[model samples]
Target: MEGFQIIRWLSSDDTAAVYEAAGPRGRRLIYTVGHRPAEPAAEFSAWAERLRGVRHPHLAAVAAAGLTDDARPYVLCDTGSTTLAERLVHTPPGVNEVVRTTTAIADALDTAHAAGLRHGTVCPSTVVYAADGTPQLTGFDMCAPALVKTARPGLYTAPEADPGPPADVYALAATAYVALGGTLPYVGDPTDPALRLRGITELPGVPPELTGMLRTALNPDPVSRPSAALLRDALSTVEVPETVTTGALPVAVVGSDVRAVSSGMTTIIEAVTGEQPRIGREKSPPMPPGLAPTRPLPVAPPAPKPVRAKPVTSKPAKASGRRTGRRIGVAVVVLAVIAAGIGGVWLWRDQFAEATEGSSAIERVDFNAIEFTVPADNDRKVTLTGGSATSTNDDGRAESWTLTDGPVFADGNHNGDQDTAAIHLVLEVRGSKRSYVLLFTWDGRPKQAQQVVNGVCDVTDMRSAGPGIELDLVSANPFADCSALGKGDTRAETITVAMRGGFLMETAPHEGATSRCELAPGAETRAQDGDLPVRVAADAGAPELAEDIDSVTVFLPETAGQIQWHLARVTLADGTTTCGWVAAADL
Candidate 1:
């Protein structure tokens, strides 16, 4: 309502609140805000600036974004009546609708991606239908945390694994899978970090014609996925080939030109992001510990007070009548006991359900507390340099590492070639707990590792990521020559480099960047380190919101300091404090 005319409140999540409104041009648009408090000022500016650079028919236009006098961040965009998500919930779309929607979105994605942009989160909800049934996408240029706030987790690809076209294609194809198959691409629980472990293994049951297209888009390596234009163009023709045209960007033709475009886009992205390019997932900064959800949690209802039995009275006249009274009293007691048992069961079920759904189910990864690695190849003929090193955190804190001893090289099976890698391991460590690792591999030539995980240079932790590690074997191995197409000739059986200990995340502090927090239910009340109760949503149902709350019970996992992660929060009586298992995800 700042400058637009409000029509009605539409919907909201922990990260944003949406409303229908009339723009200054008399056209309609959706207004969204980082409604949660203590959001980063820098992040808002970055998201807004990127939004300004994007324009497409399929993409919902960003009409406006800015800070209010109170410093609330808001964004206004084109609105649509029914999102693919909402529509599917009521009735699944026909094949024709699915094709048309996917085509339009691909065209939009191609335009944005070619210009070096990505709709970090592309799911059914973002693609809404207009009054005329035309589809348009909202929530462009959203960051990781915001996307997590809005998106259905486990549906989107983890960016740390594969950024760029590959990840975007996977999301689009996944959306198509949901639209056509009436379910997500991967059927298991979306919250489980290990859910999509195999990476598009068993393709979703789709038309025989569309299978190859989806597979190509869903390749584990970004380098292998076809461009949005290529895939969309291939799908348009009635006669599609097993392999489409322009598979590898014609590394021959667009080689230099592609690099130029990618380079410029990279420069702009780096400037705005101030972090390495996360492959697929959105990166949300962590909120301070103990803050109430910017979005309120569903507080537990007051415990049903036990009903006390009424006292029996003795005012008998005859002996027979007294015997009858005793029998009647026993029946009353039995009936009361049954009623109490039923009430207890009902209360337990209500509390159990509330404790598992919505933000109550989400887990937060603390980026600050974890450590990561920065690896490099000691190019001195099989030498791996920067093995053991120490780096400073954003707050000028120090992190130490145990690196591979100097000249760490193993002999290769092929002609005594040195076997080593030019990878900088950026690991996120949580004490002795498992650490998340990303491999930064550079060989002065484009390769799979860079395409797969964006070389993992900037992230302290990846979005929706569980515990795992990656290695960029392009530079370190001595067996393979510096050929663009032929590297890493040393097969794993050839040799191995010994290492001690593990990794953590870090980046040199930005000059002007200030710290920011994630979306909170309210002014944050950091829960003390212990048990925090939150609801975990099932794979099918919508996560419910809290209508009212007396107080909140936050269940934080041991990963609190590792990834700025937070589980969903649960509401309880104002003074109620306790812990117990209500729901769980398949780890």
Candidate 2:
């Protein structure tokens, strides 16, 4: 009799026995007692023959199969030291590991599908990892039907549905769900695949990056599920970045698979890449520039997402014109799908935004003018009431404010470039719901909050600084004197400031409009140089000016160029400051 030693029984059920055994050659093997399907498919025998010859790193290799003396069929397959289910019982896999495993399983299944085979049964318990952690799938032709006593419904789809490709995807998602969330997706009838799907809906959510894919995979209707490869791709896209720059608007979909939510973005994306965002069954490849939706997506019906046969080791190649046209067609589908579906980049974005930004509300409003009043110069209490113009609050509330004077151009405390103008808003913020109009500068720094107060005169403007952005409330209306101008003195003012390249150089607040350069050095009105000679300017009239270069550096020693200030605000390397109007005809 051929002899092999049975070292130990690993697990057992009425239908099968898993044992650790040493072969006659002394090679270790996993021996199972079941081969005859309890309810085999029509092609069971042929499929078994094919599976026996097919080999893959992720699938267990069939060592041998035979009929025992008791007339029970048995199959022996190569396996790792432990199964995924066994290891997870003792220690939980981190979310990253779960992602890796999910990708590996998908790759294997996709490979199997290409070979005209399906896992039929894919679950955590059926996948064993080598001592080196490479997963080997064991259940292929072994997938039990409704009549089979040995099957894990907690990790599989219903047998009644034949649990096709999407079923395997569902199982992989369930496994990922358990790993990342640290809990089973469903707990009730572990044998009923239908009930399990229902239970999945009630379980705690997975990591957001995976939530949408899992939800779709877990759908009871197989038609609703995305393929395993697409599920893998979805998971791959969901990494929470370590850091995001401050003040950057939520532009790209922070963590989602959808390229864009609005149709407008699709146009921009197509214009940039000459390709559109593909959606539904065949989503287009990523455009050259990475644009993603910021919304959380739901289980979208299968869009023809391209399945990669080889591992995604390199960046995707640029789309061909043919592919681009196909992508454009897919984009057209996206607009239609978006209407029918309640998910994708927008949903993911909303979920993520809520998480990162919380429910705090701070809004911005830009108006020509807003006027606030302070009864006393030192009085912190203020009231906003001035001219009549219209605007809308963040909450879409109708409000009005007026500009009593010009938008003044001042560097304030020398924080911003003096060339950038600041406005003097003197209009009454008129929203009954808004008792006080919160004032913030162009950069969103709270300038001054306008409120109500009365009592004294000589009102002075003030500013406050904090760890974050500073706040300032510039005063608009100025009076001649208490005796000359008493209470309710109405002043008509128009605000305009001359700005060069967004910098407020000077503000003609007195004229109630912005005009001219404020730095005219009264003595003779000239120009000088700054410490660093980055720029140069010249008088409108200088002989041979037409022949001179557009701009040049005089400090470089031999040039026709410009000036910064008439005052010695800029010192040279020799510790001497330079002033101007020397009037070099050509230098």
Largest lDDT belongs to which candidate?
Answer: 1
Put down candidate 2 lDDT per residue, 264-287, tens digits, no spaces: 122222332333333222111111
Q: Report, for every candidate in turn, its global Cα lDDT versus the true structure.
A: 0.36, 0.35
Highest TM-score: give the candidate number.
Answer: 1
Q: What would the TM-score be for candidate 2 when compared with the true structure?
A: 0.36
> Which residue runs of candidate 1 sit more than 4 Å off their true CA positions?
1-3, 10-12, 24-26, 36-43, 144-152, 158-164, 182-185, 191-207, 238-587
Cα displacement (angstroms), candidate 2, residue 300, comes to 54
lDDT of 1 by residue, 67-95 (tens): 54455566667766445654443334566
